[model samples]
Target: MFCPKCKSEYIEGYTHCKKCDVDLVDELPEEPDEYEDAPSIDPVKIRYAPNAIDAEMAMDLLRQNNIPCFSKHSESGGYMSIYMGFSVYGEDIYVDRNNAQAALDVLNDWDIVQGALGEDPDELEEPDSPEAPDEPDESYDNAPSYTRRRTAARVFAVYFAASIILASLFGALIMLLDILLD
Candidate 1:
């Protein structure tokens, strides 16, 4: 059987997918992914928000401005973000390469406008209570980078080249030894 959600195959005894908790099917799907037009998920971090709420606001801003953005947030205590003001691992917002420059321009303009108004977004919470200052919300949009995947093809290429060089060196060493002995 196969899990339709994850497209993972399972043996006859399994009737459901453990992770998805969905009923398995006798035959796997042959259809391609429905989100074919969606940009590839190789995300580059654009901005780091002080909290999930801010991160959400950033997402909303990007979406409203017609930029496709995503948030990388810690799953642990995610629900508590409403009550808790901060996250252990700060939230990072990402945008695809296509929309990065435009997204950065929007964020930078927001920063400049806020500075001109002498208003900190965090201070809007309450006048009586002030929290520790957070690191400036830095935007990495100009970098436009992704985490490189170490593929089997790359590993095989390195191993093949090393083995060829080793074999050639060993043969030369043996030939040199034979000549010296003679």
Candidate 2:
């Protein structure tokens, strides 16, 4: 047979080009299905629907109030779908079926719901306490005040000056003694 690309004579029944190394036979394969379906799974139930920060705060408050609670998706690997292609689930709080109502009551009583919702609840009003007016005492006004001692720099300078004076005095005494002995 003759190679169509190079025009070179090849032996009969040759499957590839001898010069260009091109496959004489077609090498295309069948296309795969793109719309393959996946098996369906069951949806999870929500025991509590606290928002992300509120849920975490509720969980901590529940634990502090002695009601055992945990995040939902963290316990069961199930996520909550909020919108189309947008889902949030990890931070939602959850408790056992028995303690769910009690947890809600504790959160309500502590004003945590309003705090988590970014609003001040009616129960958060400050209590008025009766006390004497705050004023400065007059006894300490005439008392002698103590000041901080000198820093290391000033002490070092004084010591350095004293040492120089002492050294000069000793040197002058030694020179007088040498002159008298001479």
Candidate 3:
């Protein structure tokens, strides 16, 4: 058997995917039948992902949140559909017409969270921009590096100057004490 979600092969007694927790099926069902038990309303495209994998992820998120949805890949999905993936040019994710807005909201929230986590969609493609500076993702003060360096230098100079003056005063006191002793 094969899991319709993660496509992990299972021996005879397995009824569900151990990783995805979804029921096992001999094969991934085609797009139209995805909403077989959903209400009789038409399905509408709610999103277009760059590949079938992302499209399936969106479909899974929607269905997991109780929105009936499915995905249609522009290219042949083949056996890879059972693997929760496949790609050509792109794929369209659809939801029940009445659940379109709800599905959009859920997907939008996911996008927002990803953005906040700094997972730029382009970064996923290019790994890291060659021109981009190496920096931590966390935000801090916008002051320039030179400014901080200058501030630290100034503080050290002030401390050095104070130490020199203090040393001179101590030296003068020692000389005066020696004179009194003599």
Candidate 4:
């Protein structure tokens, strides 16, 4: 006897495969080759998310619509997430080229539905280009990057300070308990 699921051969008396929990058959069907009849899956980027949460949400949406998708974190994103709580560089979501259009459609539909529910679609639309200033503004040029760097530094500082304070408190508590017990 043979188990179709696990492809395990058994004695004639054995009626099922214990591991696969499938009924045994007299003969097993021929297994197809790994690449046989399989469509070539070339991943195409569908969306760029600012963080892991957005990337996960997009991936989940695609999966619900039966589209297979995956995420690629930027080099900095992966490392930054380990140090920080989340990535700052963001992630790129990809889907098979064959399903790219369908995946986009699904995402677009989701966006429209979400907009209808509460969000303003017009506010969601990004401006084509910023209005040019008559005179160059040095402060404006560095504003965004400066703000991001300052914010990140502040966050790191706060985390480091909090950890140190907590550790000190914990150590003090432990010493107090030891003295009391002694």
lDDT per residue (tens digit) for residues 77-109 in model 3: 433344334433366677777777787778878
How do the residues 1-182 of candidate 1 rate in per-residue lDDT, one tens digit apiece? 99999999998899989899999999876888889876575556677675677778778988989988888764443533443445544577788767777887777777667767988766542211112233432444443333111232344447878999999999999999999999
lDDT of each: 0.67, 0.52, 0.66, 0.76
Backbone clashes per model, in order?
0, 0, 0, 0
Q: Rank the candidates by TM-score, best first.
A: 4, 1, 3, 2
lDDT-sorted candidate list, best first = 4, 1, 3, 2
Q: In model 1, which range of ten residues has the least summed lDDT? A: 125-134
lDDT of 2 by residue, 58-134 (tens): 66777888977666543222422332122232344555656656765775566755666776665352211112232
| Model 3 error, position 128 (Å) | 28
- Residue 90's lDDT within candidate 4 is 75
In candidate 3, the residue pairs with backbone N, CA or C atoms under 3 Å apart (3 or more residues apart, or in different chains) clash, namely none
Give lDDT for model 3.
0.66
**Clashing residue pairs in candidate 1 (N, C-alpha, C atoms within 3 angstroms):** none
Which one wins on TM-score?
Answer: 4
Clashing pairs in 2: none
